[model samples]
Target: MKAFYDTGELACVALDAVTGPQVFLSGFPLAGSDPEQGQQFLLDHAAEHGHCVLYTPDDSLSLTDLGVLLRSQQVGAARLTRPLFVKEEWLESQYFRDHLPLEGGSD
Candidate 1:
């Protein structure tokens, strides 16, 4: 996986070079800052690449809120967007989670 954007708090990674169904993660720690920047980045990448699946933590902002933001900006067609809210505990089971260390020391 390659990181597209790392803002010290939130990170946008390219899981693979697959042609369809791109995945972008959110909710690192301080993701609330300038949400639109992240939103636009995802949208632009999705448009250029393919369908985007945004995986955000459950405790973080709601997918509905993201949808609202997307709608406000008129990013793209509805079919190109997919948002999945995941529980924090699930990250522990993901092997890739261990490879990408958090901003600070491991918790």
Candidate 2:
């Protein structure tokens, strides 16, 4: 699940690729500071779907905030993977970083 937030309040959560990647969480206030709540929210939506990955904008949270959220999910037994807080450019760079050929290959 990918989450989009503004000033710490969760704005959206995408459940799957088939959902087309733009589902906003409505009708309630979901804050990034509240990791336990975030964990529960994800579990509620994605429990049967297996482990979850939360993607947020870089400006939406700091590393410390994300660490706290990860710790909370671990404590709560939520099957959540690491939260990815990054800008669009960073993601593009990451794609290249992941796919770049190694200098030393089988010769």
Candidate 3:
């Protein structure tokens, strides 16, 4: 894990074994990326649709991780794009076009 992080292979690698407390890889809103990690807020607001001051928790984590890895290492990845799961209706809507001028999403 340390070797992966030392090299440009991974942005941040938290190991479970060969060490102390297992390194936990949990998603945090770009907003709540603080020590709290939004755990308290999410628990408080059980009905809220969020994660994330970052907008989409899952997508944000993946995209941000990839971007950080590339920029930090100045390296290229074998795959440039990732598959996403989104609402079919949203993709067809004007909002998707205006906001994300990308190709289509996965089924």
Candidate 4:
């Protein structure tokens, strides 16, 4: 879809997340029938939903700090991708007893 403005900005980024081409997956849908309004509605009522996983890269770190509901919900960030998950599963396997993280949690 053709975006009207720079998507890194708040409104545009929100709209893009609702309707634009996704990098990792496709066919992701918003709550309403119309994409724009659906995004706006969700943003306007963010507290009502659970399991809303917001993925923020370094550029959007400030977003995780806003909104009372999201303030304390920010988990740790990582540069991880799909392969990292596979590697983590492998690292946890019985075959890799020597590859576990250190006692203090440093991997």
lDDT of 2 by residue, 1-107 (tens): 46555478653232321222222333212322255454565555454444334433322221222221222112243322233333333333445223222111120
Q: For candidate 2, which ten residues in a row score worst on lDDT?
A: 98-107
Alpha-carbon TM-score of each model against the true structure: 0.25, 0.24, 0.20, 0.19
Tens digits of per-residue lDDT for model 4, 1-107:
22112245321122122232333212323311232333333354444444232322221111122321111111133121100111222223344323322111122
Worst 10-residue lDDT window, candidate 1: 65-74
**Strongest candidate by TM-score:** 1
Decide which is better by lDDT, 1 or 2: 2
| Residue 27 CA displacement from its true place in model 4, Å | 23
Residue pairs with backbone atoms closer than 3 Å in model 3 (clashes): none
Q: Which lDDT value does model 1 have at 56? A: 33
Model 1: lDDT equals: 0.32
Q: Using lDDT as the measure, what is the rank order of every candidate, best first?
A: 2, 1, 3, 4
Flag the better candidate by lDDT, 2 or 3: 2
Quantify all predictions' global Cα lDDT against the true fold: 0.32, 0.32, 0.26, 0.24
Model with the higher lDDT, candidate 1 or 3? 1
lDDT per residue, candidate 1, 56-83, as tens digits? Answer: 3321122332321121111233212223
Error of 4 at 97 (Å): 29
Alpha-carbon error at 14 in model 3, in Å? Answer: 22
Return model 1's CA RMSD, one decimal. 14.1
Query: In model 3, where do residues sit more than 4 Å from their true spots?
Result: 1-79, 101-107
Please give the TM-score that candidate 1 achieves against the real structure: 0.25
Instruction: Report the lDDT tens digits of candidate 3 across residue range 23-85.
Output: 222342322123133334333333354322223312322222222110011013321222222
